[model samples]
Target: MSEHTRIDCDIHNEVPDLEALYPYLPDHWLAYCRESAFNGPDAADYPESVPTTARDGSSPKPDLAEVQARVLDDVEIGILNCAYRVQSVRNEDLAASLATAVNQWQVEHWLEKETRLRASIVVPSHSPPLAAREIDRWGDHPGFVQVILPVRAEAPYGNRRYDPIYEAAIRHDLALGINYGGAPGHPPTPTGWPSYFIEDYAGMAQIFQSQVISLVCEGAFERFPSLRVALIEGGFTWLPSLMWRIDKEWKGLRHNTPYVRRRPSEYMRTHLRFTIQPLDAPPNPLHLAQILEQCGAEDLLLYASDYPHSHDSQDFLLDLLTADQREKIDSANARTFYRL
Candidate 1:
């Protein structure tokens, strides 16, 4: 691939509304949604009014033309992650149906229309059996490169209940993308619900950290050696500290989890990749470079614009990286990971 070729690993393709999915949904679910007056799943994470949810002047539900102008023009390839909040639905059957609809909707509306685009297979992650079934349905589709699960779940993704989802993903050779959203009917933080959105938003790094710990210590990587996970939208600045802490604990406590055969940080570095959106950069660009070196994250980071969701400029971060490191983050890493 050309050094200049950029593969945006994260971008949103909004599902306009319930009506838009009506064509793809089954008759039973279509009637149920219409009669029950369901306005579709609620926004589980980002509030609609916030400027961060939709950048100034960017469309909340961008059409193909808007995406080409705003996103595709800037990159060689863009992977679409539809944050439809299907996991927020309490009814298991309905949630599964909605997930299927979302995947099909992406196929007809976006992936087919734009060859430059690829999408994540949305799943009803609350129910792993159904989620695995959804993954199996479209896992072979060339247009889809990963299985998207919300970062927030009823249990850590490494729990036994989620094994079927992982197995199916590995069988299909698809990466697992844990995007930042989902309402699992629990508080966003370990301390319980916060009064303000800022508190919840800031606490997301903790959630990602817990999931990483769970995946590593629980031996998900050991069980499925082929599994690859992408931590999307969650910031990457907290990684170095988490790696140090986990490695330290694993050294003395490895007896408790015999399945974890190697150091936690080793498994993390091998199996996980993080998108560099919402980058929590320090005041000095040199500090950010040092953090990347501490974590040995040159091959672990992937480029993402997180289109339609605003974030601070990343030119400083880009400027600090070596030409080779920047090329890997820009496109090479994603190309190899997504098998594009």
Candidate 2:
């Protein structure tokens, strides 16, 4: 394959929260914001106060250009997909307004300003129609590469309620980029909330697995073959096990999910792509290459910094791969996955 560029599939650009979004809200909502007590946590990019979530190790650049200088100009990345997350607000209408506003803010503030940057269309998963409207409104923008929804949804994303979203994505050739963030109605865990942040942070893989199963079992892939889902900031080491177990179960339970039509792993390998942020790399170092081989991650894993939040400076995981595999993962697969 001809390779000419390197892509950073995931990078965060925080929108702060409701106060930062007030200017973009409708007049009626703006009035509500001014009067109502809007004391909320910073769900946009993890609260700065939370020591674990607070960006450490890497000195963060204050603006988009400075960020690009390290990953683009210095590192020579051809494109970077910016994900602005702000879906934490409980009120669906307020969240929808925030989603619309954030997308516009990203474009005006980031996408338009940075030539090498592209963005995900932030949407209100709490409200699918409004989400689809946001996608329709901004999906075609050259600066936007995909539509992003938080993985922590009230229900699995493959529910019929999200069909409209898949339809819009197919309509616009925009991939559904699932980033981990606020799902107001749903707790992160199956049995109520966790007491510790460690639990919330580590349980991310389990969350995405449910979403993966939901999409395939619900025949989302069957319904919209063109649709792609980028599992952003999600660890990729869980894939081999999940895919193996899913395929095995899918065999005996084929009747229940006849719409799936084939191995569950097949759909996933074809339709799903993941960013390598919180990658669970083996300690042996040499085993990193083996893990990639066994998990068949050469095409599935996309290079990303999960910038300002994660630090994997030494174990980028690209160095272990053959130059050919590195080339494909670095750019070609993302190009195919996002159609960029």
Candidate 3:
């Protein structure tokens, strides 16, 4: 395969300035800023939230050119730039408005700025009704492939309140992505401490687990046969165990949820695809071979850099897959999932 064929599935586009997109919000809303200083209780004499001043003392700015060179161009990646402000806006109405505005701005400023970049519709989970409307409004954007959701709320993703949003995803032929955030009002954990931001970040995988389980068992998959779902930011290793547990429970409780027509594992292979980043080192090419052997090789795992947030390089990951596997993970899989 040509180097340009490689598709880095996961990349983060930072939102340091919301003014152009969020013209409706006052200066104060755009002004509240913080910087990650390695300080505080978990701080290494650095502040976790330090606001950076522009040379003239303005809002934090995203270094787009650097991002393009370091991540997109270098990896030869076709990027999926997930939006940021969706999770931060808590109010249902405000959240919906912000999501629409951000997506529109993304088309005009970000994605259109780069041929390789793509984006998603950031829906407001706080209000499924308005979210559904917003999804209907822009679900058909050729650049939009998934519904970006931050899995920070305590409510089960299977709750009926979210049905409209899911329905919208199915209607638009878009994938539903569950990402994580540091938003307040979210449940801390079964063992609560509210300790540190990193601690909360660690809990992201579990939140995905809960959402996936709730959706599958609750028959959301069966209901929306055409809808595809992706779990981004969260690593893929957790999937094997989660799929196993879902299967074990299904054998015992199959009668309770008759709507589910296939084994949980089957559902995963058909409707699910995951972004692979923060991957554990493969013992060798053989270990990587074994992983693809077990999981559905084509259209199963995707390549992502989590760019700017991490090194955003694919050299290590690319070295793991064989020629055939590399072709699948790099391009075919993403093209199939996003219908590119």
- Candidate topping lDDT: 1
The C-alpha lDDT values of all candidates are 0.90, 0.75, 0.66
- Per-residue CA lDDT of model 1 for 206-276, tens digit only, reads 89999999999999999999999999999888999999999999999999999999999999999999999
lDDT of 1: 0.90
How many clashes does each candidate structure show, in the order listed? 0, 0, 11
* Model 3 residue 148 distance off true place after TM-score fit, in angstroms: 0.5
Question: Which scores higher on TM-score, 1 or 2?
Answer: 1
The residue-by-residue lDDT of candidate 3 on 298-338, one tens digit each, is: 45878776653442234656776667877888778888888
Q: Give per-residue lDDT, candidate 1, residue 64.
A: 80
Q: How good is model 3 by TM-score?
A: 0.82
* C-alpha TM-score for every candidate: 0.98, 0.91, 0.82
Candidate 1 off by > 4 Å = 1-3
